[model samples]
Target chain A: MVNTSGNVLVVDDDKLICNLLQDVLMRNNVSTMTALNGEEALSIINSSHSIDMVLTDVNMPGMTGLTLMQRIKGISPDLPVVVMTGFGTEQIAVKALLAGAYNFCRKPFDINEITTIVKKGLDLRRNSMREKEVIPFLKVQLHFEIPSDIGFVRSIVNHIQRECGRLGFPEDVFLMRVKLALDEALANAIKHGNKNDFSKAVGIKAEISTKKITIEITDQGSGFDISRVPDPLDPKNLLVEGGRGLLLMGLYMDSLEFNENGTKVKMTKNAQS
Target chain B: MEITTRENVEISIVALNGELDNESAELLRENVEQLINEGKVNIILNFENLSYSNSAGLRELIALYKLANSKGGDLKLCCLQAQIEDLFSFTNLKKIFSIYQDENEAIASF
Candidate 1:
């Protein structure tokens, strides 16, 4: 017996075909698991972590190959699947391929073609797993400079909020929380930092990645001590409206910081997913 | 923000139809002040049409709330958008304001 090269799950309603494919794959030094129907195939897939690829017959008694492939995708999105169809079922094989099967082959079986397709699928699976380990998720960065006037702040905040959506913030509630944080930071920059001076400008930078988002806002005015910002949640300060903005900023963001002079504020929020 | 006031006897229902940001907060404050000056102190701010608000707008609301209380009446809120309601929660003002699900409920509170 040859050492196993890869593990492939073969599914078909016909017992003869299942054994034949298993025999062929076994001869190719590939380990094979045979399931007589889609349900059995799913059972194997759920229980076995070693399934690298699926080789399924298009027309099955229970769930068709297309349905099984979709189910497999739901279970393991990147796991490669190959579909097999008998003669005159070319259309079903094509449909399976379109539905995200790695490849399809018509039967009465070409041994070489079957082995080649199976090998390729296993290679792709191995490569994909390796890629995932090394590849970093995409990051989005944005920067804007505008007059310290409050007029431009809203549009900039809106633009950043939209980018948050693109960065996969799944909830509107989370997006709003981000918006509120930005609003408070910008208002602090314009109103207190620049003292509402139209001649001054605010510098904004935002970085959005898969794991977290960071926003930095800088104004041309003197900065203040973050420790001095009153706790709005305090019972005595509950009715005091002035300090609530900073409190909101602190609460909404995972991290909030200010420069030594108090001109710049940075806020970050981790992705909730 | 466009604030449209409807007098329900001694109570005033003020509907805000735009964002209640910094500039618009002043507009809302002025409009609500007009209602207060006219002895319509029990105000129900209908935020059904209001889409967005920040700290500036919230400060204005706090001012309005205090003014109504000082005048021996109450300021209530109703139909706040999800984000605005969240703002109230984050600022710890949700507990201070009389929030209602709808205009009728706010009116009934008074």
Candidate 2:
């Protein structure tokens, strides 16, 4: 149940369609601002103080929805944009998803379905934002330069486990998800980032709370673009022998953040999980 | 990670404990290759004792699976912990490999 004062920008060329959705959204306790085209949508977005989300039609006359989506992402990378298209135009929906739209809904949408999607999208955005805040019970900082030695990962894991134990986290969790995610992150820093150069060191900053934990790993090497990291799940990459560590970290951890240069990475884990 | 092997008739049951990671993956690779070179090819990896595992270890499993098959042998795996099962569920390895609930079932398959 969305009981808000949250604003959604509805973009579609037809006035009647816009009113219908605005009515549907308002009846569900969501407020809306409508635009007849993508250009108008952009203008409204620029003027508004805050828009929680955008629900747009893919086939708008001027400045198509996909292009508008790209422009919105440029300004607000994490703003949820629901790409709506007619029933038969699923190809555009797929394209929109690939181009980083939050989600897609088909035209002739039901009020129930649209509201549910909107609520879920807002929840996801809020949860990710919450993960960024480190309300720490305790904080630990460490630095290490892993040499070209066997079982170096084990040594690092042991050190972290010691810190986790002192912080009152459970051993089972330390051995399970924590160990796996830390191993992958450290391996990336050592092998890929620093090329296992004994002279290079990785910096680590960790915040631990009774409920959650966040770890940041920074390396000395030149970083690559985070966007170009391929999806290991893609058909071509799935069967490859290695390169699945980062993907595994994503699965085992709550959220991941990387600096623009990708040399630094942050991972958060819910200790209670 | 520690790799120790025991023979149950024609099948070699390899027990893996501790973490299976980049460094340990090499040890498992060498251990399996040695068994294959000795013409003892049918193997069942008992993961009941795995404390940790990752993609590097996964890569070794894939390579050994392929190599064993090329020589008319098969690698059967069993006793997956909840975490390992979760991992397999994502990587398509769950569908690709022959997984059993227990060492008895895995060894019985041979």
Evaluated on the second chain alone, the candidates' TM-scores are 0.97, 0.97
Question: Model 2's DockQ?
Answer: 0.35
- lDDT of residue A182 for candidate 1: 89
For residues A167-193, what per-residue lDDT tens digits would candidate 2 score against the true structure?
A: 656677767777888888888887888
Chain A alone, TM-score per model: 0.66, 0.53
The C-alpha TM-scores of every prediction are: 0.62, 0.60
Q: Against the true structure, whose lDDT is highest? A: 1
Colliding pairs, model 2: none
Measured with C-alpha atoms, the lDDT of residue A118 in candidate 2 is: 85
Task: Name the regions of candidate 2 deviating beyond 4 angstroms.
Answer: A1-137, A145-150
Native-contact recovery for every candidate? Answer: 0.73, 0.55
- The alpha-carbon root-mean-square deviation between model 1 and the true structure, to one decimal in Å, is 7.2
lDDT of 2 by residue, B3-95 (tens): 899985688999999878888899999999999888888999999999678888998998898888888999999999888888888877776
